[model samples]
Target: KRRLEDGEDVLISGFGKFCVKEKKVRKGRNPSTGEVMMLDKRRVVTFKCSGKLKKKINGK
Candidate 1:
């Protein structure tokens, strides 16, 4: 949800796919080697929450 709100692509497990608009290439750092890496732009997936589902959680 935060990723979608930030206009960034998000991949969801079990779900299909979603294309993010205004995609951009990103540079990241490697944890082990501490080396910088480049990440290519790609599509991502996201899910929408249902109001009924929220109500059920709140009931608990």
Candidate 2:
């Protein structure tokens, strides 16, 4: 988590990779109010399973 916060990616070899991605500010709408609002740009953490992990999960 700290590495991701520091803008560094973390990899666990055969497990997976954790990365931080930036999202641009954009427009969004509320489902109930139908009011449009600007969403702030922010960083988000994402995960991508390694090929080995994927294969294991798929039982292949």
Superposing all C-alpha atoms, what RMSD in Å does each candidate have to the true structure? 8.7, 0.7
lDDT of 2 by residue, 16-57 (tens): 999999999999999999999999999999999999999999
Candidate with best lDDT: 2
Candidate number achieving the greatest TM-score relative to the actual structure: 2
> For model 1, how big is the CA root-mean-square deviation?
8.7
Model 2: lDDT of residue 12:
96
For model 1, the stretches where C-alpha displacement exceeds 4 angstroms are 1-23
9-50: candidate 1 lDDT, tens digit per residue: 565444433435654799989999999999888656545545
Cα distance off (Å), candidate 1, residue 42: 1.5
Model 1 whole-model lDDT (C-alpha atoms): 0.63
Residue-pair clashes per candidate, as listed? Answer: 0, 0
